[model samples]
Target: MKKITLVFLLIILATTSAQALSWAYPFVVWSGNVYEVTTEEVKNSVISKRIGEVKTKPNDTTGNYYGNASNEYPKGTQYFAISDISTDTAIAVRVKKEKYVKAVFVHKASSHWNPYYYFILFVVAVVLFSLLGKKRFH
Candidate 1:
């Protein structure tokens, strides 16, 4: 029983650590301004300009701050200036990091894991509980 409990606790810790995020919230600080992606609108046609790349990682990626780095816009993240074709002025900025992309005009990116991750965790927990129980009984 003790072994099973220990194993279960270990599994929980591993899962939690694996899914830990650098930050939470819909806004990120760039330069000295706070940029937030509130609403998303899909445009049939639009223009984009590559502005720059994220150079530094933030000290604290959790809270809101000014003149600080953003977790979503981590180092190596690519910044793109997005503009609507109907308008000449650039309206939104898109930041792409790894497989995720976040921007004001584009679709919002979810911070939570997909349902599959939860399902996998459930399965692993069930399997561990059964196996550990069997071992204890045997």
Candidate 2:
């Protein structure tokens, strides 16, 4: 029974880790601002108007031209699709749109792994092991 419980716990942990790695949010960086597509409604409603084709160099990290070390738009500026005209700055633009850029290279928000969660898990395992060991010895 103890072995079965341990196996089940291991399975749960594996599933959680897999889910954490696979999930990702989609976003677009335009005019030095990041916009995250939260729902299907926003993704469908928001459309980027093509101004003109501009050559862009890929960044070192993401290998994307839009957001590199410079953090500026490409040389040739074309499209200007304003979802919210109220914002004066890029940071404000993110706040206004309710989509903030977590990382420039990825151009998306990544869920951070909290160490406390693992610490709690470890404590629980230790407690469970102590309890089980005591039972087995008695």
- In order of appearance, the predictions have TM-scores of 0.35, 0.26
Candidate 1 per-residue lDDT over residues 41-70, each given as its tens digit: 434244365555555444353332323344
- What would the per-residue lDDT of candidate 2 be over residues 23-125, giving only the tens digit for each residue? 2443344444444333323231343333232234334344343431123334443332334432222121121233322222233423333446679999999
The CA lDDT of each predicted structure is 0.48, 0.40
* Model 1 lDDT at residue 101: 39
Query: Lowest summed lDDT over 10 consecutive residues: which window, candidate 2?
Result: 86-95
Query: How badly does each model clash, as a count of residue pairs?
Result: 0, 0
Which candidate has the highest lDDT of all? 1
TM-score of 1: 0.35
Compared with the true structure, model 2 gives a TM-score of 0.26
Clashing pairs in 2: none
- Indicate the worst ten consecutive residues by lDDT in candidate 1: 84-93
User: Residue 9: error of model 2 in Å?
Assistant: 47
